[model samples]
Target: MPLLNGDEEISGVLRKYRNIAVVGISDKPDRDSYRVASYLREHGYSIIPVNPTLKEWNGIRAYPSLSSIPGDLKVEVVDIFRKPEAVTEVVREGLQLKPRVFWMQEGVVNREAADLAVQNGVDVVMDRCMMKEHRRLLGGK
Candidate 1:
């Protein structure tokens, strides 16, 4: 059976998982990564920033990598914002944490990485905007 599609499925994912770790999150307020992360956080979801350069972002302490996140902290979703070519590496790192979901933001799709995540029993959502989906599914509550 294939994974569910459409707003229902995407909405289900957003509701099911709240601890979202945004990989390649940018510090710039104008960046989509930052905006998405901020939106998710405002919606009562825990936001974990994964960036090598910054020590912190949006008031949350950022980890240099996915693996660097505290062991006790189990991330539910890995929201990737890197380019397509860089997604594979980001997904590889996310695998170490064994997250429940792997979400590649809009315009970012990596078949190899998606397959790998699926093989590891993780739900994959690729080429979709997390913020848009959330608003659409939940009626922007």
Candidate 2:
């Protein structure tokens, strides 16, 4: 199945899932990934920052990768901020984690990755920003 629009389903996912793994999250405040992660954290979602080069950001520990996060963080969403070509790898890794939703950021879409996620029984959202969807649907910033 192809990726779906983040409408009612996304809202439900966001409301139901509180812990999120932010792949490719940047330490720089100027980056959209950082801004979105911050927004999610501010809105009461627990964010696990995934960046290989960073150890910490905004007072939270940053894991080098998804597998590095210890003890079933119970992650519900995997928000990816990497390039389109890199999405397949992240999708493969996310499948191992078994998050409820796999989200590719705005302008990042890979049909193969989305299909792979769907095949693994994970809900997929491509070419969409999680922050925008949250604000539009959940009245969050």
Candidate 3:
């Protein structure tokens, strides 16, 4: 199998996992990361915000990095919103959590990062928006 899978695998990922650590998430409601995270949260998925710039948002504490989220949090998915160049580091750190999936949000792609995640027994998705995929594949808005 390739480092990243196709749509069928993506749909299975979206359906099977719910705890998402949104890296590079912005507190600003207008930002794409915030919007995507909020969408996921509204759809009944747990959203864990990860950004060094914030201590917390709304009420849930925002972790500074994937490595900082508590061990008991059970992050099922690591949804990355950082630039392509920054993904490798995030993937390396998030591997510790042993998440089921490493998802790079729309326009984000790093083959190296994806390969590392796949090699470690995690599914990978690159350059795709989870919100959009859910809507398209699962018949959401």
Q: What does the lDDT come to for candidate 2?
A: 0.88
Shift of residue 132 alpha carbon in model 1, Å = 0.3
Tens digit of per-residue lDDT, candidate 3, span 1-141: 344557788888888898999999998999999888888888989999999999986578999988889999999999999989999999999999999889999899899998889889988888999999999998876
Candidate 3 regions exceeding 4 Å error are none
TM-score of each: 0.94, 0.95, 0.95
Per-residue C-alpha lDDT of model 1 across residues 1-141, encoded as one tens digit per residue: 123356767888899888999999999999999999999898999999999999999788999999899988889999999989998888788888888889989998888988888877888888999999988888665
Task: Give Cα distance to truth, residue 27, candidate 1, Å.
Answer: 1.1
lDDT of 2 by residue, 60-135 (tens): 9999998888865888889999999999999987787888889899999898999999998888888888899889
Model 1: residues with Cα > 4 Å off, grouped in runs: 1-4
Ranked candidates (TM-score, high to low): 3, 2, 1
lDDT of 1: 0.87
Show the lowest summed lDDT stretch of 10 residues, model 1: 1-10
Candidate 3: what lDDT?
Answer: 0.89
Q: How far in Å is the alpha carbon of 32 misplaced in model 3? A: 0.3
- Model 3 collision count: 0
- Residue range with the least summed lDDT across 10 consecutive positions in model 3: 1-10
Provide the overall lDDT of each model, using Cα atoms, as 2-decimal numbers.
0.87, 0.88, 0.89
